[model samples]
Target: MRPRLPSSPPAAGVTRRGLLIGGGAGVGLILAWALWPRHYLPNLTADTGETIFGAWIKIGDDGHVTVAVPQAEHGQGVYTALPQIVADELGADWRTIAVEPAPLNPLYANALGADELFETARDTVAGRWRDAHAVRIGMMVTAGSSSVRTFEDDLRQAGAAARVLLCKVAAARWQVDWQACDTRGGFVFHGKDRLRFADLAAEAVRGSLPDALPMRVNEDDTRLSGQSLPRLDAPAKVDGSANFAGDVRLPDMVFASIRQAPGGSSRLVRVDRAAADRIPGVLQVVTNDRWVAAIGNHWWAANRALDALAPRFETQGAIVTSATIRAALQGALDTPGRRLAAVGDVDATFKDARLITAEYQVGLAAHAAVETMTATARFADGRLELWLPTLAPAMARDAAAAAAGIATDRVVVHPMLVGGAFGANLDHRCAEQAAILAVTLKRPVQLTWSRVEDLLHDRFRPPAMARMAARLGPNGQILGWRARIAAPATGQEVAARLFAQDAGFRTALALTPSGDPYAIAGAVPPYRMPAYAVDHHPADIGVPTGHWRSGAHSYTAFFTECFLDELAHLAGTEPLSYRIGMLGGDARLARCLSTAASLGGWEGGIAGSGQGIACHSFRGSHIAVLVEAHVGEGQAVSVDRIVAAVDCGRQINPDLVRQQIEGGLLFGMAAATGGSTGFTRGLPDARGFGDLGLPRLADTPDITVELISSEADPGGVSELAVPPVAPAIANALQAATGYRLRCLPLVPGTK
Candidate 1:
């Protein structure tokens, strides 16, 4: 069975080269969508000639409302939440609303997600808007938990504009003033007459449109934004109707299996192509400088052929082991690092003040998404088309085009439903590989990486080490704080790969004073400190590293929060109370910390028990977690209960927010327990979940979550709850037993 392509129209000639080729004001309109909207009119229309409410929404003659979700749906309920924003503002019937993945277009780029990565842009409103437009033109990606936060306003405005146009059309038809018309339940109504949106959609497209329209203020009576609407994608997913990349099958499509060099940088010497071709059902053998792949009619046959071929590679040098990588990281900590954040005079204050010091380390971890990397590519008529799960569709399209020797405009990307990403899908190597094979063979090729292949080649989360030294005052306040971290810079690695052609340009850019935003994220404590300095030493160990969920915050929060707990213990103060004291003016952090404490029944001490609390703010969300655990015999730590409080300002869906928080906690707990991706002979040793020591259902704790309601704009919630869980659990274990655990994977016999 062949997979069907989406019905969305091809994007107009919007690229720089396209603009030059198609000269006129039409190019300006295309550029405007990439830059900023100057008019409020719905610019897109459906095949039925019905009006489309901006790039995200479409109205049909049959009264169905379809929302094009720009972000990839990876079980986060984004497909449902994004449309809810539009339907709520448009006064449309929720039952009539359907969601579809938006096409690869500049209009759907993730501006908010990019803003989170750049500090200067995130700090100012004008800068954020400017960067948003820049991201729209160049980087169309889905990460940083910005799906809702970035597109909320635009989606609302789109719905509001459509409603305004519909009302005007209805008013003209009824010979009444537009102001006398009202919209409700996908209908435009006069004093005594009402018409469905389908009846007026055609007229609305031809009617006079407004340059701008105000969105209806959400009232308590008719508001749906904060309400717990059922996930629109839930039924399909539950019934196994959801289409992931693995589920995508095309007619006459061949399957491919790849085997890369064992060592990180080894070179593929050669492969017995004749032997692989002799295998039953094997169609072809593709070999590159570093990898060999086998293609066949079925995945099993392709995999079998690849294994039978047993391609060999030439070793680059001495194998790099886990011990060597750890030693290098530790050595990096001794060097003077580039300062990320500095406030007040830390050196002078730390010279005479009472000081406390601790060093923390975290090992490499994998995204380990449910579905491995997979992509299907087809080349025909000098164009390349791909179906895959990708966080960055634009980058994938560009890479595929480059690999296929075609223009970027000739490449089409169909983003399939992601089984799960956790920041791993940002790289499009699988798509590129499939595209190359498809172009080479002149037939459709579907490449699916085996579990072992996926794990071994995964861009694992960078292992990091941090050393913290704090100066305490006579009153037990933090007088000065200094933190130095050593880790591979995700930004540097990604930039170098993306711009591999211009080494001089990359070097010049790397030499700039700007820090690796991801490496230093959440490195500085959020609490009020008189003198603080945070530094980062970028160390590129042999292992490949990329962004994991929450990026540096995943490990930095654990480092800083555990150290803070140690300081509190040193000061003989309660952990929760000490955090609250440092958080003076930040009411949000304080509220979350206090709320979690209250929910977890924090009353100084639980007789014969251990309780720990941790709080952090990331990507605009504030979250706090409390863990109650007991260290059983053999030093095994069992968490009895965990409580969390979150304030992600103006929740889109309370249920989804809670789900994200719970999921994030589980993810963090797995990493904290025994999720290290160790290396042997310069290769990843973890082959599957068992080797990674993933947490099971029996290991889960009794979890409770409390959402703090607010009227502010929506904030990111996807990764906000992850950073606090590890620290809280580690602190609880430390409290249960009088030994401080400074490294991750707090297993038995580890200190």
Candidate 2:
């Protein structure tokens, strides 16, 4: 929701002001001159004015408040939710609030996200400042559900500073004590004489801005933060006015379609470029070492020409298939791995007690966003400009510059609205391809990947395999627990892809035993045990892998929670009771688990059906899920209802929170039931949606989400509800069919 220019021209003699806020070094401030309304400002300042506050808030002569949101919005309501925090603090009229995406400056970097990146650095002040500086300059990414959690304080402070400035200006203009004046609903009042912010804008600009201000804490104020404000971007999206990357149109723009190699290990052998150029409306054929694309007047023509040319690719080294991948993972599990966590003597406890061991496997999964990967690039005057949907615009800018063989500053990235991004937009291949094609063609080029190409070329969720062993005491109590997981090191892979030349990141990766936090995120069970140990074996399966929705927790939770369910059954106890018994002191997790059970009617088990429950805590939030499912003929499972209880600290917008929980549950259900991508001879087997079995509308179950209200700091809600779904459904399936399904998808005969 970028700010829109006024429809009419400004009145003559009106002064205009462009407020530019500055931060530490390397935090570039985009000039606000271009954002001002042309007709509003009378005596405009030619030189930009500097303020101590961050570059987020801008007040215009017309009393319009514009907020620069650092996070990319992809139907998550960030554009609205963030502004709500600001408007509430400023006591401004919500109708006058407008939101625009912030520039790729370090000033808007996510502080909380930076903390996650440099956890080891937290102990030292210099290290903490270094991490903060990294976040400020181009490391500003919108991932890990950090949009709201990280920026809430900054926005509130910014808004409060503006309010203080306006109130001071109004009090001085009226020759009254500032303490007697109050600001509310975009107006300054002095004992009943009210003045609109618009009338005092000029005087307010001359007032000194506060370096820092205490944010007002009013739990009862429901106008902004706590209320379910309608999403500002929703109207545009529903009315088809929303502009996505695919909707970008430029003068002399040509469409291009690519035919990529199977995986990173594959190479393009040859392509009939001349034949492709001969096709009707085809402009030119562009080829690199690894892939080729056809530029044409239209996307369909380019796509047809690309298909007509039919580039050939060959695998570089060893051919990898599903069977070969599984064997390699199993082999890695058998080898000695780096121990991530250890407590007490697990070996002795296991030797003295009964052992229950099981191995689980999860296949590679696709992002499968509705919008196909797309980017529009224009090269002119020795500079490049790109419009695309990306979660990491700064990273994309760097990658595009490298691909275009130009200086990073010469490239400008304009992030467009994304249709969806379940961590698929983290890679900048689309932007790189578009830039290269634009440079080669010497014109504006729009490149798009067809559904088949997008699915096959995606940086898929890494395939994982886990082996779990639990030692049980004579009284059905858990004595010891051990887990070993083997999967592609996603941290190493992402580091190599995004920061191959970054010495600091490389050193950090080398210093840490586990390559990435995602490698063993949830490998160790949360429940307390006398002796517990977890190990991770990093594997290179010759397939391109990246972060999925929940990252490593996506599969690790499935493995650990399902194994816990197995242990519960072996102990002849209900899943809920078994979990409660183990959760001795964790009141948060216990509350979520019991709340979900109560709402789901755990005690009233339905005849001809069974219910299962699972809980997990990650990303500073706790969640529990209970699923009621029925098994039909031929072992087909249909979920009747799903109940979830979430404790994400304090709530922002209950409606949006519920939406995220429901969406995450459905997404996880798709993965649990029958969503996967297979490989054969180093090539993806599933070409499109027809083969990749995603959940349909009829498959959606009745979902109920209950959120716990607490005064604790807010946590992420986007991916918190997904991790427990697969295990909960699997447990329910076991209850219905008397079969223990360990692997994902729960396909028949895999029990």
Candidate 3:
């Protein structure tokens, strides 16, 4: 449970940290803003006999250790993985460790996530003291697969500091120096003398920390981090006792069902209040400039009332159809684009050699999480409390505060276990709507979007058209390559909405003077290319675009790997060999390709062989995928087997790594074969999950995953396997049918 923390800022400290006694107004204000000293006290509630140690840990008299986790649990094993890190470092028994969702505090702010959101733009008014400023503003986001990579050091430091303090107290009692003490199995030891951590906790809080924290080195699998520990959250999930946002309940609560404007530059035209009033249980109707809602005691009544009311909306700005979306991308592709990345003079190399060009298309893809948009909110006594499923608790709190016209300090957000996030939890529109409804009704309110509403309002992965151009050397080697992608500046768009003062404004083109590198993330090849260029052509498709699971890497990998397969075929080179030859100094990716080929029984992707190969690098990790697949009757894709080899630096939990890879493979296949929709009159063409051909249990294939063991810093694994699945499938189809399919969803629609 996330308990309420201190809301006010700390008092002034004037030693060398700030000027408090006397100074000019200008100097004092600058010092106060930039150098003022502040301390954040731990607010994680402790039991009667428990004691708080720093901000991240608490210890009970029974030796139970509770650790605070800032990241949300969204199917990934963050709750287990992070605690494993702490347990390993603290030398504590794993059985004694428990997890809690961290409360809002600067000590728990996710700096890595903040950097990811503001990739290339910090030229804002909040640039000064951005770290402190962002934390106070509720920027504690949990996206970007950065939970371990960014927060590991801080978590380890917290554990180590506590361990040292405990040891210091124990050493004092034993008449020994603290530096000669060690911790293991929840005890502090020195020369055959030992003290349990629980016995030292009462006095350890007064001990000072050393200048440098001592870190634990993993020497064997016996260490908790290297082993595959049972998931801490699995028991609750299996017992059906896990609490999500929908499970939140409060006294005197009402349910709401809403319908918002469907298209661009429009608002709610009218609603039949009399018709809604006629519904059996609907108590009231609420209308705003952008949406209308029906409130009732039961959710069904509220939902039924909306159907009877039949609200109408008028849209302008050229009806956004599939044809219009494609045209916008094509127009942008035809125009000159800004260069986001360049290694050498691509134009000069292309001028001397004949250019081989291919353009690939991908339509709009939805997140399709099992749990739709849901939030529970209560507003009373000038304070609002929200139970929300969100990656950014701070952003949701701020947005809800704005929607309710209250101060941010007056709002508290309880981040709940997500049913499925995959980047969908980053948007907080539902939280804002719930806040508005709670304020309007003067009672606790729970708002849920119907499945259709979730699909129709999904900020889709942008529809993009990528033009890939390459010049081959005389000896079957790539001399120069260029990938010009036309898609919305989605990264900037998200950052704009996330960091904007209003929090309602959702455009970033003006804020990002430098072209968005995030739009073309993973566009640069990991191969040894002497010269290549990647450009971004920002297309205004009049449809809101947000991050998908793998972000731009999913589509960009498809474009690069599939086009490289085409080039290999044209040059009479084997697909796997052609890729392995361009490894440069990236021996890790080379080994992944070689291992996958050997294990998957690759047959060179020859005609009628039904074998394919694709590899990619993302988030400091390398992956290679080999699949046995072909087109069946009626052009349906059938994959018989898949083999993946990955080198993700280190595995905090090997089981979780394999789980992510397997889940990502199926997710990417769905995106490639069935996870897309077109727009007609500004509404999504597909309405529900049944329309999207998601994989079922019976459709499973033979799968093998090989995790290379390395002692390097951990890289991201959650989104690693998603990028190459589509390209490998497309490459397999090319080998079997001798026809290159360009667009996504390999069936039905091709742009």
Candidate 4:
């Protein structure tokens, strides 16, 4: 039976009836009564003495309140921050709170992110349904730093509803009005009369729920949202009990190692199956069009078998070389491309002014996560089960079922903890391959990509080039700015491949939206420019590119900030004051800049001080970075210190915010100094971490981050710090050496 496509979401908080009217696609919406899923049955399994409360809460006999967190734990502290929300709203003792991975269900889907990724702005019936029921159509991914922002309200409501139910049960037993009873520290209280929630939880689910759930109002003494709770996953990690995807074990599981076409393109031409079979401990060799895998009881044996097989692949066209990529981008920029952002008449503003022009280039950067791709699959009775480190479990299940030749409902995905970041876990090649291996071998299979294979096939951050031309006038007040960037439409491809509801819709999305705003997101400066235009010259690099640490801002920030420094120099003004002056309305961003400068010991980017400053706004978060570095005798850039100020607003865990900022700083530093590679004969020159020039303790600078206080709603912190570091370091180096470097992987001797 063919799988059914998702229909339009319900209207007015009720299920939609009739049909979905998409972009000329006459697809009918399913009847609400048949598949509304408005009321979801609890999917979490309860342990002995534990009572289930809806889909998110479970209360054990000993008073432990466990909250179900749906996002994959990827060192972002979702397990801790999310559970903190539930515990705070439920008025439970922090010590009594625990967390479990939420079961895969529509109730736990990331609908907002899915809708925002690709939903059309056509104002049609499909457009109306975009924000709702997206997970039923697209996927439940955990990227975009949206876990806290998208799910906060839902988690709060779930906790509040549960608390109300528990309070009512307690109030009934105490012979008091339920409205007069309040909960705190895992107990219900009414004028000095109290009872443990554990004692009443068994009967709470049966109580009459109010028409409207009451959300918590956090005041002085009862708020946990701002406190720095100890990370819930820390203890398990230290004790080596955390179950990463690689740690999953099953009865009679076989290990598989695969060899795909190198250089990210090819079809398997031939392989020596007999040689692979002769290898000691080798179970069998499975070959597909795109890759071949060797299965065995041990990974090492399987890897050796793969090596012995010596698979060969054939390429149809000229392999993408660095020269080709450069030529493609240069040609695109030379052409009159689509303009995505315009503040005023840039051509008219620049007509009579002497423009300060510069060109900057950034090379390809890989995700380079320490953990490679790993997934476990077991198939039996036409049903497939997968244990994988993935942000999109629903997407994985749907794709895996297809690969295994089974119905969509016959698949279940048990998401495991991952160290995946920068979109490493978003790919489904491993899951698809594992499912195929399991169905063919008639046994359980666990596949792990070797580091070399991981590097060779990783979806890299697209290489980009920007030509910046700015007109600076008297007093540095009158200015015109134009940035023409050439890069791949990464976000468009992501939307088409991962976010569209069906293949037909995906195809339509990929073809349309020819002008991609996401490709040139940060090209426009935050400063006050009289006239400015940001244009995107979409280049077909003939290589795969996906979301990096900061999306397009990773490169665009470097482009904008570094150019701002050049403009400041041309105008003979202090770089810090010049940027802050342009920040007329963004007080929050200006504060971040000022605070970072103070923290780093502001010295005006002087000749010897080696101080440089950069600030940016991303994902509703504002951040400023300052770097102190020097170009040494051999042109080697040595970083001494890095200081950052962030205003993410309403911290769930201040410690986590600080950690993310710190981590982003280090990741950015690596990218600035060594996180780039060039393609040669369809393969990247950097093959491993050693090749990428990762910073060690000795090479790392002393880093400090300050979290600004704000009562505003929470903003994303994970990728906020990444975009500004490169430009800060580059500007600092220019201040020290009196020379400018316009390319990434800043080699001081280059121009």
Candidate 5:
């Protein structure tokens, strides 16, 4: 039977009464009914036996209370970090407490994602920090650096409220006045009377939300404000049975391997399925726009059949090679057509003062997470079910629902643990494809993208071309700045959206030079320059683009910091001291710079080893990086040391913060050095690991030092670690060799 087609809308844009408005309303109502206002934080209780220092405590009929968190664990350690908050506040034994992924609740939305909505006017650590608690919409998600900040209030309140409720329950059962019942070590007490929290838990659940709850404080309350605690998930992860998305398997499910056109522009002109069909367990051959799938009883059989299937594609034009993109980027630097930022008399400043200008070219990069893109979808009875690891599942849910012609409520999205995300899962092609095939055949299907296709067709971090020019006064202050950046057309759109979001604030602040960060030294005028201005000229290309680990900030910081270092050298001052002095009024910038410098042992002097630093504030966290590298013979740049410091106020788990920083650095390093997804004549040129180079264990640096300041406002740590790495490394290389490399990858041996 032909699949039932969704009826077309009657009023052009409007669909059938029940299918459009009513269907959406029904879904919304269901969502509302399933969630409650204070639903974000659920109360955990001990049974009938024991309790700890009142924290992580559980006196159970069996003796246990387990904390629950809903944050997605995509290798960022949110699962491990958030529980630390509960343990710290409860003065509980951290070891005895176990944590489970919380059910979907409205309360989960209060953190980082909420802050993103509040940060509409600007994207910065300060912005997120200032509005962390005011917003509400509890849906647990892991994005930005909100896991700790979002749960800070709710979790603390839950623990404190639980304590109050336990005392109330104990006092009522003992027939004593509430005041007479004092609580200590998870037990309620009246003179010569005591009842453990485990015994009182059942009664406590009958009480309402506690209004007044006691708080835990350290010898110095401020010290614990941003204290680092051990990661909660580390023990389980070390014990060997942690479940990742790839580990999931359903009964009677079959495996599939898919192949797509090597050239993105090519379409399937033909498919010779005779040989593939003869394979023992090969179930079917499914072909779509650019994808051809081979389904079999096992993954190996599918893979073998996929390899045997002969398909041909017609090329659109000459392959738009990497050399072409490189050349185009260089050309864009020569003549900028569109300006995104402008302030003061930029032309006058450049013409009047001593200046330097250079063009930097960056290559494509990949999110080569060890786990390839994979998904399982079961389509039956006009309903679709998806099980995959994704960073943006809401969008996926909508897409899957629309495709299946079913109520979104009928679509169930189960988020699984990811081995790695690195911003790649932001798009859900694999899940969509898997669902489409399953729906077409009315059977469950699991599709996996081969590493070759992943590399060849992967959406890459937009390649960028940046032109930097600066004018300095005789007093060692910067007078003017000009930057022209061009990337794929999609980047311009992303930039436009980001720029538009800041338009109102930019107009209100009338920030000098540039309104956005990294524009005119984040508009702080690093070196007191009069008649200052900053401008951006948008250039366009054909490559598809989206956010990488650090997004645009990564490339922007490299250009801004490297140029600033050059300006410092011309002024005859140490780069560290020069930047520090430039940050005259920005205390946040100054603090991070100072801290990072201190961590890197910035004492000056190694004639060839120069210190390079860059500071940025994103998603409510201010981070600064310092790099010390020896750029010796062979043009082989070896970073001897790297120091990263972040002030992301109130750390729930210090170890996770450190790990995120490490991951961000490694991710950024891959982009800076060897990572590339090159194409030719609009066809992918790079095909696999060998073609698309990534940082290997052997390529890792000697040492990396991380220092986090939870004392300050908490902002996101995931991507902040990346933006500064490239610039820091570039600045150090320039300091050491006295020859600034103006392109990415610095080309192994060519400087």
Candidate 6:
């Protein structure tokens, strides 16, 4: 449960805090705007001060402790992780700790948000607090695997400073130096004089606060790394006490279900609202720009109403049919686009050595989050209250405020527990829908998307087609390579630029690959091949392609690693040795490859199973993965084992690292062998679970091992493990059989 802030101001601090007196007019404006809403500009700020949950964390006289967390609790385990960070820092009594979510604070923002807001429209921040003291970015949303990374430093520093302050208070009372007082488990001790945290709370607050403090985050100060600490959310999840957004309930809240246009965009010609009105408990039928929603007393009633309310839409015929899109994407591989990268001269190299060209294709995929799209909104008493769990809150706030015709301040967005958000919740559609309906009805409305709708209306992972051509030197070295890809323009252009600045790669040429792991490898690889050129051309398409875990790196890794295996085979050298020779002295890559190979029993192992390796560096972190698979006579491929090694620099939480690896492996397996968002007649054909074959528990590999380097900084572990899995599996298959499969989800006969 979230903690409640005082709606009314406290008598003492009301004047100083700008509470009741100056706030009422603001509140009135907020209310009036909610009634006749307009787009609400959020008051965003970024706080660089020492943040303690003090206003959030209270020490009762009886020694009970409560810490208020500003972030939402979804499956990411913020509830547990946040409290753990606080408790460890404060040396608080863990048994007596109470955790609660804090309402929006305008003092927290992500690195991505910080970079973006500052990168463009510098004037937008005019007159706003930009300094560390007053610039606190809030509305507390978590994404980009940033919760731990962003808050860890500040919280630790605050805790350490607080402890030092409490000891000073005890020392002052004891007439001793601050160093003489020892602190342990929320208590300060001076010789035999013992003072509980609660007893010194008032004095500690009055004492001088430390403005500068360094966190002793070494291994000696923490037992956090390389340990499988139990997940903080497990108990609540097991007890059914966790409150996902779908579990929200409010007074007089009507239910709503919307049927989106079959085609992406179309004109609504007619809607048969009468049939829906006949449903028991049905309230009203509301039509919006792209969706027709049924409002009813209950969810079932709303769904039934939606079922009966038949609407006709004029199609644009612009929807990309799955088969047509796949074919088109493949054809686009030949079409030229903006040059993203280039290295050496691939055209000249192609004419010099034995060449092998292979094209691989992947299909659209959906973000099958456990909790479907849902939000609750209430527009009453000239105010709007919204309960939603969204990845992108700024846009959500604006959309909801605009829909309700209220000023932003009049609308309050309370992000709730998210069941499972795999990037799809970033869209503001649901929030907009709820606000529009609730405002029209002048009542509270709850909207939940059906499974079919969730899948059909999903912004899919864009289908990708890559044309890779490589030249092998006589000694088996890759002399030249060229890769051209066609897919939706994800933010890869930006990432590629960043990668180039850091890696010295040519960003202007489209075919140049980033961080060519095998480029400078020993003996030139494949016995020895020298001088290579590489580049990439990402074609633009209409499909809605965004970040799907590892982004562009996913396909790039596959093309590079699998193509390496093909070259090794052509040169008649063992794939493992060939890779090792190509990736010399890169200790991180070597560790990962060797660990995966050793674990998979690759050296002189059985011929039925083959092992393949791949490695790449992303966002300063490098990882390598190896896969082992068994191929039977009937064309059935069983993934038997996987081994991965990662050098993330330093480990924050080893358990989380392992979890990320497991997630990446699982998701990659699904994408590699089978899962796809199918389409028919320019519309999504795969509507629900049955149509999309996901990786079931039974399909999981029997053996999986994750090896971490002893010394390294903790890089991002969330999405890095995915890119190598597909190529590893594909390469293994190539070694197992006499086929070089270039497409994803290998069909029985294609290889």
Indicate which candidate wins on TM-score.
4
Report each candidate's C-alpha RMSD, comma-separated, in the order given.
Answer: 5.5, 8.3, 4.0, 3.3, 8.2, 9.6
Off by over 4 Å in 6: 1-74, 96-106, 113-141, 180-184, 189-194, 217-227, 344-354, 492-541, 604-607, 631-636
Compared with the true structure, what per-residue lDDT tens digits does model 6 show for residues 1-751? 1122223333453343353344366433222222221121222221332223243455666665566666555565556565666666666665556665554544344443222211211232221212111123233445445566666665566566667777888888889988666555667888788888878876676677656654435455433334455666677789999777677798887899988876455767778888988899998999965889988888889988877887877777566676667666766666654444455566776775666887777777677777899999988877778888865454467567776777766777777777765566666678888999888988888999998888877766666776667777668777776666666554443323222222211211222233222111110112223444433344444455544555556676776777777777778887777777876466666666677777666753224457666666654466767777756567766776777777766655566667777778887877787667667665677777767677678778864656565665445556667778888888777656657778777654674
Q: What digit string (tens of lDDT, one per residue) describes model 2 on residues 405-441?
A: 9988889888888888667888889998998998989
Query: Order of candidates by TM-score, top first?
Result: 4, 3, 1, 2, 6, 5
* Cα-lDDT of candidate 2: 0.78
Residue runs of model 3 more than 4 Å from their true location after superposition: 1-43, 117-138, 190-194, 218-222, 502-512, 748-751
Whole-model lDDT for model 5 versus the true structure?
0.62
**Candidate 4 vs candidate 6, lDDT winner:** 4
**Candidate 1 residue-wise lDDT, 1-751, digit = tens:** 1112223433564455555555446433333333433222222336674567667778888899999887888878898899999998888888889987776555666756754643334444344444534443445567888898888888988788888888998888889998777777888889879999999887786665666686776476566777898999888899999888878788888999999887566888877877887889998888998788899999988998887888888887668789988988988897878898899999999886667899999999898888999999989888888999987777788778778778787888888889886778887789889999999889888999999899998988889999999988866799999989999887667655543433332433343356676787897898998899999888868777877888889899999999999998888888888898999798998999889988899866333457888999988889999998877766676778889999899988899999999999888888887778888877888998788888789889999999998877788888888889889988887777777788887774676
Task: Report the lDDT of model 1 for residue 304.
Answer: 88
**Whole-model lDDT for model 1 versus the true structure?**
0.80
Pairs that collide, model 4: 10-16, 19-29, 20-29
What is the lDDT for 126 in model 4?
Answer: 46
lDDT for each candidate structure: 0.80, 0.78, 0.83, 0.83, 0.62, 0.62
The candidate that achieves the highest lDDT relative to the unseen native structure: 3
User: Which digits, one per residue and each the tens of the lDDT, describe model 3 over residues 179-260?
Assistant: 8898888988898999999999989988888788877664765467788888889999999898998888899999998888
Candidate 5 lDDT by residue in tens digits, 587-607 = 776788888888787755235
Which wins on lDDT, candidate 1 or candidate 6?
1
Residue 720 local lDDT, model 3: 91
Clashes of each: 0, 11, 1, 3, 39, 39
Compared with the true structure, model 3 gives a TM-score of 0.92
> What is candidate 1's CA lDDT for residue 37?
31
Higher-scoring candidate on lDDT, 3 or 5: 3
